[model samples]
Structures are given as C-alpha cells and as structure tokens.
Target: MSLEVTVVQACLRSGRGGSRTAVVEDGDLSDAARRTVPGAVGASQAVFIAAQDPAAVRLRFFTSTGELPACGHGTVAALAVLAQRSGNDRYDGVLHSTTRSLPGHAIGNAGHYSAAFEPGPIDLRAATIEEADPILSALRVSAEVAGCHVASVGRPRLLVELADRQTLANLAPDMPTLQAVTDRLDLLGCYVYVTPSSDGHTVARMFAPSIGVPEDIANANSTACAAAHLSTRGHSKLQVDMGDSLGQPATMTATVTGSPGTPIVEVGGTATISGRHHLD
Candidate 1:
C-alpha cells in the first residue's frame, strides 16, 4: 500500500517561513501506518483527514511519538491543502477532531493560502508560586519575568512573560528539566514570550521536549493561549512572532472577542505547499 503526503509550511511570515507539516488526505491507513507518516517525512506533526464533507471535515493529528488531541498549525496546513485541491478561493465548515469540533475556514488564490479555526474552551489561571519556581528554574531565568500563568485552548501550556526581548532571545532552557516539569504539571509545553511591541506584535517561543519537539517554529494554539492571557489585561487583537530562534521565523494572529474572562479566541495564519512525497 502507498500513501501520498503533502508537505506544507504553515503560519508563514510574509509567505517565507513557517513550520513544516505533513498532510495526508487519504483515509485508508491503519492506525499503525498513520503513526509512521510524521517520522518518515521528518515532520514534527502530521494531519490525516479521515473524512471530508460539504459541511464538516474529520481530522486526526499525530507526532512521531504519539497521537495529539489537537494541533493548530497542522489544522491550517490541512485546510490549505483542501482549499487548493477544491479549486475554490474560500472553504468553510466545521472541523471535527477526536476530542472536539469547531468551525474553521480556509482561503486561497494564486498559490497563496491561509486558514483559521476556533479552538473551543479557553482557560487561563495564574500558576501558584510553587509551580512557577520549577518552571522558571528549568527555563534558567529569574527576576526578569513580568508574570507567569497556565493557559489553555484545549491543551494546557505554561505562559511565561519576560521583561524584554533580550531575555527571550537569550533563553537556553534546561531541556531535560523543562520536559520533566511539563510532564509533572500535565502541560503540553511552555510558551515564553515578551509583551507586545509598539506595533502590537508579540514575540514568543514554545518548548515541548516531552513531545519530541524541543522547540516549535510555530505554535498556533499557544498563540491562542497568549491571546486569551492578554485579553484579560485589555489587549484583544495581536500578531505573534515565533520561530526566529530556530531561524524559520513564522507568524500567527490571534483575536479575542466577546469579553475578557470569557473571550472567544480565533487563530489564523497563511501556509504554502512546499513539496509532496509517496510513502509505503
């Protein structure tokens, strides 16, 4: 048996840099075969479209190590592929994953594509001092932090705020300890960021060694979490800049509407098809 995989760069910064994702449209793979796609293609994550309908699409996400409940950038990559294949400039419908469903849409024309989705249920709360200590220590910084909180939009991620971009740039986390701390706290990863700049652009980085991705070039869900965290303090719309640390600089936008505590979060970014491959 053979499968076709489309590689896409999602959440591109100026149509140039983004995270590499593998998208498989075929739904005939066994669970065992599906798990091998990410590793085979050297992609951090893979999205499988199990079913597609006029009104809804069912998707499954996987990393080399295990299945993921949800994946933001992967979702974007999948939708962009769908939009391009359909020969439509815009595509909109519900997106169903194993854990939940949400409305999503994609738009494309002339070789450019972008997608967005609402990840249901947003949660944010300050981390207890005890919890913050280990995380900060693992990150190897102190006193330069402005705030720290645990935020989630489906999966929990620790949101750490630094005082300036230099601190963010100089981050050299203890990967082993950070992985241990995230595992202990039941966190997907830690998202450390500096506040928005004069132009409302938030620069950030995501680390999740526990999941085999020591550093993520682009993390849409974490950006959504950052939006939710900042919404509570009055900033509702902003763009997050990530991946520069890895030299694959990517960008994603998060918009928080409705209200502060109960805000609705939507994340969007553009993607481009980089290549394709056949696997057996």
Candidate 2:
C-alpha cells in the first residue's frame, strides 16, 4: 500500500525557514507503519490524523526512533493541513492524542497558516549540580550558566540558560555523550537558550539524539518549557528564536497566563504546506 504524505514547514521565519514535518491523514495505519513515515520522507517527525470531526481531531505522532506522546510542531502542521483541506480559513476544535487532549485553533490565509494549542500539564524545577554537570560536559561548554532547570510541557526537557547569545551560539555538543545523559535523566532533550532580549525575544536550540533527532530546527514543546521557566521569573509573553545553527531559522510564540508554579502555556507559529511525498 502507498500513503500520501503532505510536507509542512512549521514555525517559519519570514515565510522561509522552519522544521519540515510530514502529515499523513490515515486512520488505519499501525504504530509500526507510522514509525516508518518520517525516515522515508527525510523528516524528523510525522503526524498521523487518525480521525476528525466537527468537534475534535485525533492525532498520533512518531519519529524514526519511536512514537511520541505529544509533539508541538507536528500538532501545528496537522491543524494547518486540516484547516486547508476543509476549505475554511479558520478552524476551532480539540486535538486528541494518546497522551492528552488540547483545545486548538488554526487560521489559514493566503497560503500560510497559523496554529496554536494548549499543551499538557506544566512542571518546572531547579536542577542540581550533579544533573547539570554531566549535560554541561556533554555540550563541551564551560561558560557561566545563568540558570539550570528541568521543565516539562507534557515532555521533559533540560532548560539551560546561558549568559549571552554568543555562548548559546557557540554550542557544539557531543551527540553521543548528550544522548547518554538524556537517557540517564529520562529527558526528551536539552534546550539551551540565552536570556530574553530587551524586546522579549529569546534565542535557543534543541538537541535530542536519544530520540533520533540530533538537532531540531524548531522544537515547540521545548519552547513551551522555556516559557514556563521564564514565567516563574515574571515573563508573561515571549517569542523563541531557534534553528539558526542548521540554517533553518524559525520563530515560535509562547504566551503564559495564570500564575507561577501553575502557569498555562500556549505555543503557536505559522506554517506552509511545502510539498508532498508517497510512502510505500
């Protein structure tokens, strides 16, 4: 059997660079089959739309390594494709996945789409020196770190804050060592970022070799983790800039509401349907 896959680039910067994700609208595919789509299409992740209705849409996410409980960019890409196919400029519904269900909305305009959704629960905590030392060694960085914490927006990511953008840009992690550290810590990936600029924009990058992603062009869930970490420090809204190292520059917006220790985070970004693929 052959499956048609729609390629979408989410979290684009000026309609140019973003993460390329494959979206497949098939309900009958097994977990094993879904895992093959990403590798076959040269994409890091694939989203399967198992079912849809006027009120809700069910989605499943996968990487070449295995299935994921949730995915931020994949969710945005899937919602954009669904809105376009429905011939509507706007779509409002719930996104159901194996791990959680989130209220989501998408807007399509002039061949571009913006999608946002509430992620799962938020958890943030400071990291001990023992936890931080191994990761820092793997990253091969001795620069002064401003803050170190473990954060989660359904998925756990080690959020490391550097003193300046220069330090953040100079990162060259040992992928093998970093992967081992993530596995030991039971983390999804490591998110290294600089402090927010005066205008409330942050620059960052993500690495998750344990999940077969050596470097992510744009990581929405990690962005949410950053938002949650900063919200505790009195930041309510901010934009995250990522993907520059690999040349696929991307931007994602994160809004934090409610209060500290229990903040609500919403992640969103624009995406375009770049092309398609046929998976056998």
Candidate 3:
C-alpha cells in the first residue's frame, strides 16, 4: 500500500510562548512534506493539520495517537495561517474547527481570521470514579482527588480540581494511568484546575502528558468555553492560568455574557509568528 501525507510546519509564539506544528495530510502531497510535518517531528508530538476535501477548511489535530477535536495553540496558529492561505478572505467572524465540543463546536477569533469548533458539552458526568485514582497517579498528583469533573472544551479532558494551588503545582503523575484514564473514560486527558483567591475566579492548568504534552500548556481555547460555562453558572469569570508553575506561564480570558446556548466564548492574547517552513 502506498501512503502519502502533506505536512505544513507552522510556528506560533503567542500566550504560550512558542510551538512548532507540522500539519500533514495524504492524497496529493510530496514525499518531503510527510518527513517534516508536525507529528513526524518526534514520537507523540502534537500537530495541527487541516483536512480539506471539498476545499472546506476543517482543522484536525494529529497527535502521536490519532486525530483530536480542538487544540487551542494549534487553532491560534491555524487561524493566522488560514488567513494567510485564504489569499482573499479574512476570517473575521467565528470560524469553526473540525472538532466537536459539548455545546456545539470550538470557535476561534482572529482579527483577520477566526475559527469555530464544535466541542462536546462541559460534561462532568463522563468522568468515572474508577478512573480518578489512575489519572491522579499518572500526573503524580499526590493530593486528595476530591473535586473531579469532566469537560468537553474542544477535546474531552478530565478536569480535576485540587485542594489548592500548592497541591496543584506539585504533581508527578504516572503515565500508564494517565493513558489508562483517557482510554477507560475515553477522554482527551486531564486538566488540573483550582481557585486561588488572588485571581477570584477559578484558575486551571491543563496537561495531556499521556497524549504527548509534557508540561503546562500556554493557552487552551477549548478549556476557555468550559470555564465560561462554569463562570456563568458560578457567577464568576474563568481566569485560566495555564503553563505557569512549570515557569512559562500564560493566561486565557473568557467572559460569561450573552445568552446561554449561543453565548460567545472569547479568549484573548497575542500570537506572534516567529517563522514558517515549507514541507519539501
């Protein structure tokens, strides 16, 4: 069998600092393209690629494992790339990502271009008691896993609210269990969130070490929607402090205004394009 993939290596230096993504797709791509594409960079490296058939720009996440729904940093990178690729149109409105969220789809907003992604609802029910212990062990979180919930930001992730910031910061989870939880619950991974009085709203840090991420994530757009829902319900805005504690800290902001269903979930930050590479 002959296999081919077209990959685009996109760079984004924004809220989360910087990430190099190599997007790959088969069917009309050169051999060189597949060699340097995102996931091909390393084992399990996360790459954001667009699956276009009818010329429809639908974004898909190509992790070391398979395709994922939504990816915040990748989407941001993609938005900027899409704007440049479209050549004519500017994605000013909320353009949808390929992934599905609980509410509908994940939405990304760029001044020149934006994306909308339909993610599953913010569901705490999908998380099971059987999976908690294994997940906590995977993250190396030794704290008491009391408040555990599941949310479908863009891709489904297990949200575990720790006792406090101190506990949240110090974690060294077991990888097998981490992978096990997602395999069992069939979630994206786990995002450890907490409420630090200094911030007022709940502060969360996400990690999918099992799926390929090793440290704190800079900005999670998908998580922003879930936080928005939680914020609206809790009457508090979600102040997501991601990628910090691990040192390179970044923040994502989402407000709780407008109607419940079609409510607008906006995440704000600066995205800088350090560089771009052509695949073969």
RMSD of each: 1.5, 1.3, 5.5
For residues 152-178, what per-residue lDDT tens digits would candidate 3 score against the true structure? 665566777676877876776666667
Query: Which order, best to worst by TM-score?
Result: 2, 1, 3
- Deviation from native of the Cα of residue 246 in model 3, angstroms: 4.4
Best by TM-score: 2
Worst window of 10 by summed lDDT in candidate 1: 49-58
Looking at candidate 3, what is the lDDT of residue 79?
A: 55
**Candidate 3 segments exceeding 4 Å error:** 1-18, 22-36, 39-56, 84-90, 93-96, 99-121, 124-126, 144-146, 196-203, 219-222, 225-229, 232-236, 245-247, 258-264
Collision count for each candidate, in order: 0, 0, 33
In model 1, state the lDDT of residue 119. 84
**What is the RMSD of candidate 1?**
1.5
Candidate 2 colliding pairs: none
C-alpha displacement of 91 in model 1, angstroms? 0.9
Looking at model 3, residue 157 earns an lDDT score of 69
After superposition, the stretches of candidate 1 with alpha carbons farther than 4 Å from their true spots are none
Instruction: Please give, for residues 1-280, the per-residue lDDT of candidate 1 as tens digits.
Output: 5989999999999978899999998576777787788889888899988655656678888887788888999988888887887788997878888888868888987557989989877788998887788989999986568998988766788899987888898999999999999999888999999988755687999999888899999999888888888887777887989999898989999888986657888998999988999987
